[model samples]
Target: MPELPEVEVVRRGLDAHVTGRTITAVEVLNLRAVRRHEPGPADFAGRLAGRSVVAASRRGKYLWLELDGAEAIIAHLGMSGQMLVQPEGVADEKHLRVRVRFADGGPELRFVDQRTFGGLALADMVEAAGAAVPAPVAHIARDPMDPAFDPDAAVTALRRKRTGVKRALLDQTLVSGVGNIYADESLWRTKLHWARPTEKLTRAQAGELLSAATEVMTEALAAGGTSFDALYVNVNGQSGYFERSLAVYGQEGKPCRRCGAEIRRDPFMNRSSYSCPRCQPMPRNPHV
Candidate 1:
């Protein structure tokens, strides 16, 4: 899934290319991927025409296209979705879901998703993605990138939970913008075990962990986010370089970067969690 950095990158790219341009047309190749408005192809196209994108912004992974009135077009990339700005004559990719042509001769904004789990919606509901708890974005407890974010706030949020540090960090409502990759990397950087329970952590430990998370995520954003699978790409269609900088996210069974012990991958729900046993040892006394 595209996290905050990737979503921010996409929003910035689209803002430069599509903002202020009038929507001349909308082509929906897959109707099932759309929601809230336009039950079919014709209706979808009809609803998008003549509207201009007054501005573009992102809250977590959801991208917002502000139009006239209180209406806005909302999009979520899910796992495999990406927004691309292609030249006028460029051929559309096979995964194209929808394309918007602008009246200002700017490049077309295309939504492409290989898994087709992504969706689009038209709504006057202006709630940011993080406002809804448990839907990925809302799970984040705190984000260091936020100007108002304090390391102490992050510690306080985790202090109330008994969940494992990894699990708590993965909760989007606790912090916005962090995904699996960054979570593992941040935990590793702090030399904290994934199995460490939140309630067991001291305030100083929690502060250190939060600071590491922020630093790791900021570094990833600067590098354009990690691209392990074919899922993530910049708006310009270039790959993110952060994957090479990963210390523990996907290096299971390999030697730890900080310690000689082999990295481990523990199964967690649908996905797996990676860490270095030597660097992130399980707490000697497990939380009872």
Candidate 2:
């Protein structure tokens, strides 16, 4: 799944390419592409026909296109979803699910998803965290990169949880944006084991963890986000290079960049967690 950095990169690209453009036509090639709209594809295409895209916005992993009315087009870029901008006469991508043409008749925006797990929906705008966001994303907390993000409040919420520190970090309600990859990187940077209890962490330690998460994500964003495969790409279909700089995630049996200890992977929530045993010593009473 695309994380905050990847979503933010797509948002930036949409803002640059599609903002201020009016939708002249919308072709829903697959019903599953707009399954979240509930009213079906016809209603979905009808509602978006003439609306002008005011801006492209995002919260955490969610991306949306702000329309003229108090409504937005929410894009769910699930595991293998993509939003690609292509020239008008170019051949359509094999997995193209939705093609949006603009009044200007220039390049068109395409939604291509090989896995079909992603979709588009029209949502009403609602206030969330002192800003207007699609109603579906109202419950998601502001990310570390958000201008109004409160690090202190996030730290307080993180420590209030009884879960493991990494689990707490992955909680979108506490601190939006940090996913499995970034969480492991952040924990590695803070020298905190994934199973360390959140309540056992001092306020300083919690703050440092959040700070490291912010720092690492900022760097990842600069690198266009951590793409391990071709599935994750920018609007221009460019893959990120941050995966080359990863320290622990998927680095099983590799030497830790900081301490020379071999990195290890452990089962975690049906996935996996990576860490350096020497630097991030297991807690006396690990939560997992």
Candidate 3:
């Protein structure tokens, strides 16, 4: 799945080419593409047609285009989704799901998803934290990279969780944009076991974990985020190089970068977690 850095790169691309453009036409190549638009494809196309995109914004892993009205087109790139901006006459991608053409005859905005897990939706905006965001996800917590993120408040809240540290980090209500890969990387950086009890962490330790997450993600954002496969790429179809710099996420049975001990992979919530066994020892009585 695309995380904050990967999604932010796409948002930046859209802001560069798609913002300020008036939608002259909308082609829903597949009904599943607009599955999130509860009013259906016809309404989706009708509602988008003359509205100009004012801005391309993102909240954590969520991306959206704010239109002239108090509505926006929200997108979530579920596993294998790509937002591409191509020349008008370019060939349609093999999995092209939606296409948006502009009135100015500029390059077209294309949404392509191989798994179909991603979709588009028209959402009304609601005021939250002095900014307008899609009403459905207004309750989500601000991410570490977000300017509005409060480090003190985030650490305080994280220490209050009764769950395991990694589980708490994965909770969107607690902290946003962190997915499995980054979660393991952040833990590796902080030298904190994934199963450590959140409530047991000191305020300083909690803050360090948040700082680690921000540091690693900022680095990933600079590197254009991790891309182990072609499924995740920037709007211009460029792959990220962060995968080559990963510390532990997928380095199973490999030597730890810090202590030279073997890195380990353990089952975690239907997924897998990678860590340096010597650096991040398991807790005596790990919280569930």
Candidate 4:
């Protein structure tokens, strides 16, 4: 799952290479991955053939390419999907799932996915751009990175939740773009255990945790988003190096860099959460 930083990097790369280029043709190897006009794949290829890419942008993890006319190309890279600008060659036929060729012939924009979980949709560009798809996710408490972020607001959001802090962080509606890596890093920074209930924190403590969460995410984005599984890559096919700089994530059984306490992992939902036991002490459950 490419998070905010990964998606932002891909969006920037595509904006530089694909914007302003007029589409010469459309090729779809997997129809299930695309949603075309008229609700089928028939007019899809012809409708976008001569249109120019007016702009490119990203909201959350989805990427949008604005066309000169009313149409827009929307893509969700899911988990294993990757977009790259590569020269025309026979090798691309194997991995390339979709391509939008341009009139300039400079390079082909290809969507490649080993898992084939990614998807695409074509619709009114404005509708797609303005889709009721919940911008900035309402439940995300408050983004610590936002200049307007309010710690008081974050404390208020968490003051009543019964779920574990880590689980709360994973809730997209609660805080968009924060996944396992950032949640772990943020909890570790605040010295708050993942298993602790959100309501257990005092307002001051909750504010500290929120601030720490934002700091970790902002720094990670600056480092270009973590990439250890090769699933998250830029439009240019470059992997992020933030994984090399991670403090607790994927460092189980290793000594905590801060306190020398052994790093540990705990199962949460369908995935695992990592942390430093000494740094993030598990608090006792409150009286019912």
Instruction: Supply candidate 4's per-residue lDDT for 81.
Output: 77
Question: Taking the tens digit of each residue's C-alpha lDDT, what string does model 1 give over 99-185?
Answer: 889888778889999988787777664345434222223333445676666677767887777788878777766766777888888
Per-prediction TM-score, please?
0.87, 0.96, 0.97, 0.82
Report lDDT (Cα) of residue 274, candidate 1.
90
lDDT of 1: 0.77
The C-alpha stretches of model 4 lying farther than 4 A from their native spots are 35-38, 43-46, 69-71, 123-162, 286-288
TM-score sort, best first: 3, 2, 1, 4
For candidate 2, what is the lDDT? Answer: 0.93
TM-score of 4: 0.82
TM-score of 1: 0.87
Q: What are the RMSDs of all candidates, in order?
A: 3.4, 1.2, 1.2, 3.8
Clashing pairs for predicted structure model 2, backbone only: none
Which stretches of model 1 miss by more than 4 angstroms? 36-44, 125-142, 284-288
What are the per-residue Cα lDDT tens digits for candidate 3 across 1-288?
A: 588899999999999999999999999999999988889999999999999999999988889999988999999898888999999999999999999999999899999999998888899999997878987559888898888899998898898889999999988888898889899999999999999999789999999999999998999999998896689989999989999899898899889889999999999898898989889999997875
TM-score: model 2 vs. ground truth: 0.96
